[model samples]
Target chain A: MIERPHHVPERLGLLSGAAADPFLTEDLLRGVQGHGGVDLAKVVEPLPEDDARWAVEPLRDLVDDAMFQFKENRTDADGWLAPRLHATLRLTRREAADKRIWNHIALAVAPDYVAWRHLPTASEGKVPRINPVRFMGAPDRQCFSRLWWAAEMFRNGADYTPVVRACSNQDLIHNSLRVSLVDHRPTAQALVRILERGTATTGREINGLITAINTAGATVIYDAFAEDEPRDPWALRQWITDAESAPPVPRHVLPTGPDEEPVREDSVAKLTEYFADLFETAPVRGRTP
Target chain B: MKFYPYKRLNRPIALRVMSATLKLPDGTFDPLDTSAYSVPQRTVALGVAQHEDWISARIGLSATLPPGATDADAPWSGLRVLAVLTDGDTNLRTTVELRQDAPDSKEWSGQIEVLRDDHAGRASLAAYAVATVDGVEGRSITETDADWTVDVVSEEPLGGLRLDVKQAGFSKSAREWLRPYADVPWVIDTSGRLPLVMINTDVEGFSDLLGGNGGGIENKIHELLLSQMATDVWTAVFHSAVGDLEVEPDGSPVFPTDWRGEVLREMLPDVAPGLHVEEALRRVHRRRTDDTGWVELQTRIHYAAVRRAGASKAVANALRALQQMNREDSE
Candidate 1:
């Protein structure tokens, strides 16, 4: 019998030496081990691993695509990753609200990615640290959760185009997501229209417009003017039910969300015009008459 | 009480006692409703007088003559008349002083003056009295023909008026209270050791914490990186920080010292190669214009508190550190 040495090798062989080092690889493996395994079956509940409803492999594929597609420009990763992440991880709002599932994924499955993505700068003058909340927290603060929500909120009906636009402007997303008014589909789409129109170019402009809109909301009734379609509860239920047979989200093209009606065009148009006027009158920093 | 008697020789003297009744144009007893008098029976009694002949005698017992009631006094015009009456118990007291002047005309339209005293000797008189002759009502001076119309328009002595009260929320009070602090730019003090220590301490743990999936580290890192980049780009494009920068006296560098740009410059070399300062500046400019796409992806996580065993000192230190870093970068 060959005797195993007491001391193990300093590094573990995984990917190419250039691509994978022991520390990162070990950390990644440990992260997966910490939660059990990377199998979607292990992380998700009420959805078995082998069940058709379980799309863990497909989700893993999506993450891999994101890693490859955005290899050069990581900042550009969000636009590509958000909608895809949402598509791959098909979940109901109730399921998503549970922080445990997200915690399992972050801590147990893909901690290495979290570390890789979140490493602190040297100027920070401390060991790189992560907030435990990211592992399991509210959707707004969760690592993967915020992106999914952003995509979900900004997407216009089945179209993900507006999501892309809205995600592009970090200020808009950061500010808009915090505002309850953006839940109104027309308001979200109208904001995106403003961004697309180049009416709000700067962060301050976006912030100012958001502030003005929020302030104006105190007086004017936005819903009275910009009406939206009533949501069909059955559509979401149908979509979630269809998750068992749903195919992987297309990589090259933007995936379609539930077949809900898009925001009213007339409503969006009216808001676009109204918001434009507001932006004109808004007090943007350093903007002189 | 003096009673003047013109005797009809060997016959009973017939002296008719005249009394006057006055009514406001609205046909109401104005003084009875408004007067501070303890007894209001006098104005009602005068208001119900029957005829002109009864004016001089019945009114003489209770009511004071109006400004124009006697020719020796000035004519009363555009003044409300209130009938004054003596106490019922003192009906026999006839010699009384009229505090105000009597009206010059018999058809007098003026206020009647009355005097009164409590049993405690606290004597006071009505400021003015109203009197009108029965069967001789005067024409109303006002176009609106209001009842008991008094032309005595007096300005209130007090200058200010009380307005309606309003209620506000906690945030409103906070904003109002903090407005002064925000008015002038808040100059971050960088020389403080607390902020530096706190920032360094947090930054040390930041990397490890930021790593892993679904742990918000990635999002946080992304936000920090973008914020750092944005600070640099804004500085490059605008030649200043978006917010105010605090500087030391005599043009010396404060703690913040535009550290954001320095940090970005250090990281840019590692991220992209062969980039000159001019190119780097240009890149920042281009990113500023094109980077609107990343805004939505940025998530804000508020750090409620980072205290040590229920002590806020640690968190306070952390804030100081953040402020110091910001100040140094801006400088």
Candidate 2:
């Protein structure tokens, strides 16, 4: 695998699609060649120089550690990297929505990580290419973004433990992230609890359950039945503000998220029971009556 | 009315916004502009990006249930009214309980708190009357007929499909991308947070063609040009919306939650009449992916786009103009 960028910037920069496309070469995606930092640096639109949050070296170091530690099991990296990535790179949803920053990170800072993580297994004669979507696509598909958003979605306020459990199951994140139904805090927690209980272990079963939950959500407002508390916005703002002075997220221990209150216990219990009932009748492809 | 399997209040609940205030960064409350809300449209624009620092908003709500709601013979007991604030974008729902004005009175009032950080853009505020019925707790009996929109980031107090329109000289514009399309009269970009219609000022008289309010042929032509632009925009956004749908485990397409959902819900009926929006979406998805009947569906898509653009109305006006012109020429 290729090494990290030779010269990391002081702060992160935005890389537009027009600028990033040239470096996304077929050879680089196929894992044979890589883009050197020198040429790619010219096109990057740098973020504000004074913003401490935009610093790049910490992010580079984190990804490096992730690659080295999970060298044996690539999929295991997701569970480890998600919470840490979210905690280390603190951003508001508005800031995170900007694709340019994610593009810069993928193409300029960590093309090697993207290639190593997403490069497909080799066939007898077919070339194994990393999907471009992993580098620069929708939030649910992109390599780094999917993890960050997974943590944001599954994290019960200040808790990051649930995020780890959600990321452990790739099928859960891959299917659940696309649906709006999971945005409900109780709904998100209930799904995680279902996963932990080993009710819907397979990808097909998880997919079936998620589909049923979303379809049923169209008519039934989950929030009404499973009531979630009003989140304290001050807690979230304080969390984002504290990122400036906060220390590096500990490697061994899971990092904490925003200080807002977790989903109510009764609410999660209500949805858990409702979702379990739905799963019993959900049309899993191979499940027999 | 939407049907409920369980017993519910037959009459709709009367809900209204009493007042609204925004909390500033320095622990002070600023009364939001009275113009922030549109009663007819059921929308509240909590100012623009300037209010981003505003921590939270408090909206005073008043609701009156029907006469028999509080009677002894009422079907359900333990009745409670709640004001709910929900943002689909963030998936956050906050509910506040409302107390009765007097013992056994039908009137209820309360203040609902809206956290700014919990919402990214627009959140909806609605009132629901709930009570235990048939052994089910927190069962909704009635709700506001139309939920009010609370847009934290918009300057205009309006709701639904507010497509942005801007004018810039394509050749000399700050947007480098538009320079390449300098020759085109207008362009529609659906990739951003909201759909935008960029009118090229470099194309001389193009703005005049679109903006002018003249008599006879000039007016007719202006309307036609606008209709054409609207047609293109609706078509582009519709294609963009339907082209990228998330599928269920059983291979059925799921409706999007963003502006794409708005576009689909608005246009799907015209695209496939007499069918539910979900069914229409499925048909559209099947046609596109299976590569069968897609070519045939183009006419329906075009017709839908034209209907939304009001092209038929423009054509009617143009016909009337043509008839008048011929009569004058013959005279």
Interface RMSD of each: 38.1, 3.8
Instruction: Show where candidate 2 strays beyond 4 Å.
Output: A1-49, A98-104, A121-132, A197-200, A204-227, A265-289, B1-5, B10-15, B48-52, B64-75, B103-107, B144-146, B169-174, B205-224, B312-331
Give per-residue lDDT, candidate 2, residue B51: 63
Note the residue pairs that clash in candidate 2.
Answer: none
RMSD, candidate 2, Å: 4.1
Query: Backbone clash tally for model 1?
Result: 74
DockQ of candidate model 2: 0.33
Candidate 1 deviant stretches above 4 angstroms: A1-51, A121-124, A130-133, B1-331
Q: Write the per-residue lDDT of candidate 2 for residues A93-162, one digit (tens) a residue.
A: 6567666788888887888888878865566897877788888777788899888889888999889999
User: What C-alpha lDDT, on a 0 to 100 scale, does residue A130 get in candidate 1?
Assistant: 51
Would you give me the overall lDDT of model 1? Answer: 0.43
Report the number of the highest-lDDT candidate. 2
Residues B20-60 of candidate 1 have per-residue lDDT tens digits of: 22333333433222221213211212222222111111122
